[model samples]
Target: MKWFEIGLVVLTFASGIIWLLDRLFFAKARRERAGLLDDGRDPVVVDYAKAFFPILAVVLVLRSFVAEPFRIPSSSMMPTLLVGDFILVNKFAYGLRLPINNRKVVGIGLPERGDVVVFRPPAYPDQDWIKRVVGLPGDHIAYRDNVLYVNGEASAYQTIGQYVGKGRGEEMTGATLLSENLGGDGRHEVLEIESPLFASHGAGEWTVPEGEYFVMGDNRDRSDDSRFWGTLPESQLRGKAFLVWMNFDGAAGGVDFGRIGTRL
Candidate 1:
């Protein structure tokens, strides 16, 4: 289990138990002794518990079921997302699940092609990784000549000219920016760098199995995604990432207020 989650759960439960015990046993004793033995004020511990339990419980519920915030630590999903961007993941977008185990307890929402998601990758189960869902279950996915082909249908890409990188993404400066259409209305921006020296760059092929998904990064040549680690299991899904609420670009030395509230 994640340490933050474990600590939060433990603290919330411990405080709640103390408050319950005070209400059930200690409060009556205090009232009985108020006549002569002592005053009726609750102990400091009880007071602290009463003050913190509600806030902790609300936070736990919101983070576990409603939505959670995550920071973008890499340039994997660049162009659409950026390094240092703080994104909001919709916890219930892929259905409500238990926090630690990630067992889906309710709802039947499944991720579609081109959905940006945050999940525990099969390569590193303990880490939270974000990538765009490129291939759903039973879909044949192929990456050839730096182009995406799904079930023999090549993805459409519209060049958006050279991308000028900002902040930590300065290394990716001058990469070709393109708009990729992943069918339906699932359109998103991506970054690509054309290298003629190695023609077949980042090429791969895979057929997604049942209950698994193939993910990829928008920074086609830079991301370490399903192209390297294999498919992401359905049980490993955390949530669908939707928005960037903040960006604290270390290279820029401060928050980039323009990236605030960017839709993913």
Candidate 2:
């Protein structure tokens, strides 16, 4: 994905430069020679640049600052966000950032508890991972007996029956579903596998460091999140996820239109 971002920035800049250069230096010559044997067409490269520059620039601006699309690749988020769900992340929800390096140019908002966010993991900066923000900077975070506690206050969980997932998420069926209220972030559903016996993987108390955040997945027992990798750095924050644009799981199922447009 880092490569993709780099390539996009390069392509957009190259196309824009080509188009601008032609306008300043080559366009007048081409127009002056319009009556020649040539079809009066701009050079092939210039023609392409003129046609694609606007489109590329628009996409770059939107993806870099307004919103960006990301597809869920694993079942870690479970019933809340299915595998193969194409989601729209609000890129500027946290701040305005440069495209490739993701350096913030203007700060906007901070990740709130319970908001689903996409970020580059500390262990793998090139990759993006999405999870729920559970603890903010300087907050006391703990996970014990499959329960999440923030600043010594336990989140409320109400039984929501068994999870019946679809497409690639079908394997997660029969897991216990519950509605969790993260005090400040509102309510969301989570899945816990009862039959397998819940084993707390990273059960311990941790104080979120300054300029970092603690995140976790809705599928409590299966997520590789802050519990395993430590707090997420503020600089690696990408955006807050807000919508599911599409879903396509090639394993036994294809597109699931029902998931499209789902608000996270």
Candidate 3:
């Protein structure tokens, strides 16, 4: 089932307020009138809920409209994002869209060629996916011999050493790292695993239809992105991931100080 995080936040806020009002006003008044010294302390659950409700509500509003926090779960964006990295996404960069429904009420800007975007899966609209925008509306995209071609022009790539994933991503260490240039905008590092017979190695040419975009993960070999399911509709876009606020891998206790404040 598709769970709505924003809706959950609203419920938490409402419940907390009700609990606080009951304890501070009604309960206190009744106890005082009855001459009973005990005013019945609020339940532990109620206390915690009240304490965290406001904070979470503010976060939910900021996240749904201004910016949102997300964690990289896999190495699909390796070399750019680590598995334990907690990143921030710009919610208003694309447009002001309501969470859950994802209907863009305002059109602020269009997705650029080299932008890192988060969107709902076209095949599975309930699932959130992130990738780099390769082909915009009406752009032809193709991948041959692990090289990307956009609109009949090949993207530039230079070998940049090897990726050495550590901690949670240790298994993917020593993969090839390449400095990729997307249409001369900027250069970014990408991880490429040497896997022969990979399904995404050589994809047939695909033209992004109107109101659609073609995306691909930085980790070319490991991602199941647009190449597998299909292009993402414009309405499916969520936001643009931009920063890493925190990182906690669970296996590694408290926090990963290295990934904090890292920009995406």
Candidate 4:
């Protein structure tokens, strides 16, 4: 479990113990000693628990089951999501899962193609990764010559122009931009560098296993994704990113107000 989650659990447990002790033992003692100078009605621990318990519970519920905020750390999801974008992920969008452990307790829906999802890669369980879903379970996916083929149907994309990266994204300059249309899902922007396919280029065809998903980054050539690691397990999925609440691009300026409140 994460340290933050452990801290939350500690807070919740401590608060509950304080409340129960006050109700069962301290309150009766205070009532019996009402005539004494120290009645123990306003103990410091009880006051602190009363002040923070509800707030902590609400935050835990919201972050664990409702919505959680995450900051993009890399250029893997560029164009659609930037390096400094602070995004909100819907925790219950895929299903309701317990925090830290990530064991699902409620079934809501499953991820669809073209959906931007956050999951822990099987190779690296401690790290969190965000990518676009390209293939679902039992689907045939291929990436050859910078083209994606899903179930024998080649993906259609329109070349936009040479990608002009901005701010920290400037490092990705010279890449090509393409407006990719994932039929029935919607359209999104992707970036690809012009380079000859070599060994370790992360190109291949795979039939996704059951309860697994194939994910790739918007920055095709630069992303180390399922193309490199392998299909993501359904259990490792964290949530679906839906909105960009803030962007702090230190490389560009300090803060970019234009990207605030952008929906995914």
lDDT of 2 at 229: 81
* lDDT for each residue of candidate 3 in 135-209, tens digit (9 for 90 to 100): 999998988878888989888999978787777777778788899987766878887777776645637799999
TM-score of each: 0.96, 0.94, 0.80, 0.95
Rate residue 138 of model 1 by lDDT.
98
Q: Mind giving the per-residue lDDT tens digits that candidate 1 earns over 46-88?
A: 9999999999999889988999999889998898888999999
User: What is the C-alpha local distance difference test score of each model?
Assistant: 0.89, 0.89, 0.80, 0.89
Task: Report the C-alpha displacement of residue 239, candidate 1, in angstroms.
Answer: 0.4
Reference-based TM-score, model 2: 0.94
Give the alpha carbon lDDT tens digit for every residue of 79-150 in model 2.
789899899999999999998888999999999888999999989989999999989999999888878888
Give per-model CA RMSD.
Answer: 1.5, 1.8, 4.1, 1.7
Give the per-residue lDDT of model 4 (tens digit) for 123-165. Answer: 8777778999999999999988888899999999999999888
The count of backbone overlaps in candidate 4 is: 0
Q: What is the lDDT of residue 165 in candidate 1?
A: 94
TM-score of 1: 0.96
What clash pairs does model 2 have? Answer: none
